[model samples]
Target chain A: MTDLNRRHVLGLAAAGLASTVFSPLSAFADEKELVIGGSIPLTGVFAFAGVAIEAGISDFVKITNEAGGVAGRKLRLAYEDTAYKVDQSVAVFNKLTTQNDIHLYYGDSTGFAKTINEELNRRGSILMAGASFGSELNNPEKYPFQFMAGPDYVEMIAILLEYIAKQQKGAKIVFVNSDTEFGRDPIEASVKRAKEMGLEVVGQIVTPPTAVDVSTEILKLRRANPDFTIFHGYVLAPLPEFLSQAKQLGLKSRFMGTFWSMDNSLWANVGAPADGYMGVMPYRYYYDTAPDAPILEKIRKLRPTYQATGYMQGFLTAMLMTEAAKRTLDAGKDLTAKNLKAALNTIKDFDTGGIIGVPISIPGNSVPVGRIYSYSAADKQMKPASDWISLKK
Target chain B: MRIATAKETYIADEGLLTTRTQRAWMIVLALVLVLAPFVLNAYWLYLACLVAINVASATGLNILTGYTGLVSLGQAAFMAVGAYAVAFLDGHLGTPFLLNIFAAGLVAAAVGVLVGVPSLRVKGLYLAIATIAASFILHFVFTNWVSVTGGMSGVNVAPARLFGIELASPFALYFVIVPITALMVLAAANLFRTRIGRAFIAIRDRDISAEVLGIPLLQYKLMSFALSSFYAGVAGGMWAYFFRVVTPESFPFATSIFFLAAVIVGGLGTILGPILGAAFMTLVPELLKYVVEWLGPVFPNAGAALSPVRTIVFGALIIFFLVFEPQGLAEIVRRIRRFFHLWPFKT
Candidate 1:
């Protein structure tokens, strides 16, 4: 052989780089597989929810396949860890969609959902649902291809408002939310709803998402001293301190939260301080053993530990997605976004196998149904405190 | 070995590509760019568009921090200004995409001049802190300015239309983004051949000395800032078009640090630095992602387990480059070119 010089090596490297970049990617999934793509935040700040959500989706897919699949076509999950960043989420969307014949997608955040809405409308192939309960996404006109598993943030707060209206007439309420899109999502709408329900809006306090020492916010809370304090847009932080300090000051205000912070395991970390803390949750808890909830029982048998509320949300989202797919295929129509979403809208009084305490209907983009659950320090669980309340009613 | 290149005239001597080989290589690059979209898959095209946007922003950062020696953590903020401007113009006025991008650059440049007023009084890390403060102020404005920015909910951007065809997909956008990035990079490379560019260099070396050499420090500094922010603004406009949404949280403070790190790691003060740096920075995470996927069969839950490790490896790679290759990947390129120039000769 001729001398293998550095020039030859360099030329070969350049050729390799070009070929790798330019090589066409073939479709990875066969026609029999209905791919469910996900931009899951398996890392970064949202990883706690992400891990559970991934497991939830995976378990649902496994269970569905074992039960004879959706309309005889196996469900395939193609996902990537986005680390909860919008750019990464978009990147994952592009990559997964390009590689697979995806008809359903699960987004991670409100930002990603919103950012990809235009693209979704343009593609008209995939229908999306996500962890976002942002009030803005509730509009089907703007986000036609997108839907959520539960009530939007506003409806979640409205459920709480309805409960409070029944429990105590004209209850003075204070809104404590973080300074974020997620935090501010339901404040304005919920405030209007609260007034409509004849509840008095006492004060609104906005704290930075990174606020570790909420001393000043607590001082504001003391001044408001409403009958009920509703916290939004936060998963865990500052609420524990807020509750502990409010208790220290002997404030009689009842602390409440929305879906995200309503998880029993999350509040259990605060122990006795989380006692009597209440929030609106759209789904049954992991340990919830109501006679109607066969799905929860099946979930418990699969994993013998307390699953976070995120797991339930993910499991239910997957269940709804596949149900839509099954409906579309059952109608003998193509699996286009329009067909899938149209089929989804046709769902009324649908059973979630007791994932929800009651039969639910997707009147629009959201389930618009939730029940108030109070955290008990003694049992370390969120016990149902109210009957299922639907926004349509 | 080949010894010397003879220049016949002053024009020939001052030319950017003094050798025929360089011009031929440039032609090859141009050909590659022209054919890229046709050959590459959608995922790669998407990445290419993203890399182009990042390259544009990183080049702007390189101009200020590398050429003018004024550090800024406000590049992302300037970009945000551009993105918001494009979104507003496109939404309200229904202006053409090109005009919206150009107007966005002008708006960001004006903001840059205001932010750079402190740079005259402060240099080095102090100047960096000032830019950081400016970034925070801009973020607050983006968040609170409900009428213009749509508050935290933000506004959706209409896809760019070129001659009545919507450039919505990454495949369509590749042509728009890549050519614009190439032109911007070219303009930046040509900037160093001008009087303003020389002034920037002199200021970078020593601001007092540059002043002694009859350069007005504040004017030149502000000019540099305007030019840099203009570049960043244009990049941000492109970003808005690509993503089709402009939220307040689009450009976080961490993004500024990313561009700064790109400039430093790519080889500070070099023309080729930002291009290579931005591409390297953008692609490395993607490469790491593939590596994790490859490890999936061997290691269980590798995607989840190695996700954090990918971030650590990214940080470590930057540190490694800073330690081992201070001049960056550009220097490596130069060394390889030199080795090729005298190949097969034991000099």
Candidate 2:
């Protein structure tokens, strides 16, 4: 009986100690502190995008801290590297939401966003903003917590197909993609979109994700002699190599890619060969003298060479989070995940301060349609191709 | 009578004891195993579950490499096969999770027989190379085959369920996995005592001599492969069900290396060695993570530095164990226990 009593006392002591440790920053505290989690690709295949997403969150935190923080308490941003691996990201997300008291999560990749959306919704985490422009993130009914900031890669492919049908006369389009999710996702959407747009998909080739020496595939492309070739790939290094090889092989194919393949680093890797290469971008480059905007200034401060793709992505996501937080505070709601999501839904016609040179807005459970921009190495800028084309419902 | 028999069996073995102190330690392990989930935080429970799965995998590898003297670098491929099989069956048939896991292992055992056919002709490094090739080829097929294997996009494994109860919760899931793993290990311990087990040891020691002794060396070696692959497959299925997702990247070439390293560092050719090795390898990282978290405030850039430092330290520990004590941590434990039991006894 004495031993039982002693064990009970010990258990109560442990519980008492836990309450003391957890109570200080508890949601029950007077001014609640919101915890935002980022499961980002800090290393691996898509490290570039991962680094950009994190910088964006850090800037958002800095801006919030400067502006008296969220509801007078600083927002705590906790990030874990997912390395662009899905299981690792899921594990990180589980840790953040289930174990730690984080309510908001920001994922880096399309796969990360899609995999964890259901889990986040089930757990009542409100806001999940990721740089992944996959259509899977846009469904309000399926994934309410997920709010994609920019145009998805599918929309970009559709826009690219539209341009190819109109601008390049008699151009037969051939899709060369890696044999992975990133490669296959756009292919499924674009094939249907291409049929709708009346562009001929001359050929389609699926290569390995880490494929080197694609001489065989390039030779196959040469035989197809398609004027427009869209290379849907993940790695930055290999796409340039593919381009250089294609040019040397005299394929005479005009190459473009999804957002990942559109970076200036491609041009730096293979200068003149990558001249006519173009891919769709959600926004203009940071150095573009497009218009007066606050985001441009922020971008410049973040990087000297504001032309880097990372700076632009970082600036855009940060702007979205900042706007969401401010609106939440204005609503007189605590900076909770639920309140933040409600604030995001209420946002409309907010400017990204000229960083994107395009006004950012969200209306009726959808990101405002993003305009397609094409990269030009001669001018070293991404000029607006056309106005924002609304995706068919 | 069983205890007496067990004591009598061990009495013939030198430098080993069946003392009261040893029995108490076993009882302590039993208590820890039962009470672990209650005391451990969710993070620890998750880590422990992973450790258990790794132990299961390492134990299987021990049967092939440790017991049968076959070095394999294709354990991950077998794991992938098992994972995909379970994933496919569960998605298609909605079979009970336990049945699906066993089915997956059985399917992998069939594949292991096919791979082991070549092992009859080859020996030593040649055998290792053949298995390593199997790992690479399987990894490639998993990555490229989109329709069946889900390609590189990966496959989502539905949460394991028994009857109507969801094993989605880590605690509930841990209970399910722990018992199954225990059963597998118990089965493995029983394996080494049988005629089939002795045939494996005989083949491992000298195939020609075993053949001369009228043991079907080919049949026994292939059976080792089948058993080893079956264990790996079951472990893989467990991993998939536990994580609720399986990607091609999840079972990589490096994972095969990890399994071999665990067995070598755990104590090859012994029953308890693989579990001991897996626990050490798996827990070391978790321990390092805890230490890093505790020391984060005091150390500059501790958060970023900790992961790389932990990885380096882990690698170093593996190398240290290999160089100094090739027999593994199991030997050290046995020694410590022996010293305590033999205290003040001159002989």
- Name the top TM-score candidate: 1
**Each candidate's DockQ:** 0.72, 0.19
DockQ of 2: 0.19
C-alpha TM-score for every candidate? 0.96, 0.86
Q: Which regions of candidate 2 are displaced past 4 Å?
A: A1-31, A108-118, A134-138, A284-290, A302-308, A318-343, A361-392, B1-17, B132-155, B290-295, B298-310, B342-347
lDDT of 1 by residue, A1-393 (tens): 899986799797678666656555554768788889999998888999988888889889988999989998999888888989898899999888877889999999999999999889989999999999998999999999999999999989989999999999999999999988999999998899899889999999999987889988888889988999999989999899999999999999999999989888888889999999999999999998899999888899899999888999999999998999999999999999999999999888899999898888886799999999999999988999999998864
Candidate 1 residues B1-347, lDDT tens each? 33577898987887888787888999999998889888878788889999999999999988999999999999999999999999999999999999999999999999999999999899999999999999999999999998999999998898899899999999899889898999999899889998999999999998889999999998999999999999999999999999988888889888999899888889889889998999888888877787787788999778767888888898899999899999987897888778767877952
TM-score of 1: 0.96
lDDT of 2 by residue, A103-157 (tens): 5667877666756655665566457777677665567776677776666667778
DockQ of 1: 0.72
What's model 2's lDDT at B295?
69
Best by lDDT: 1
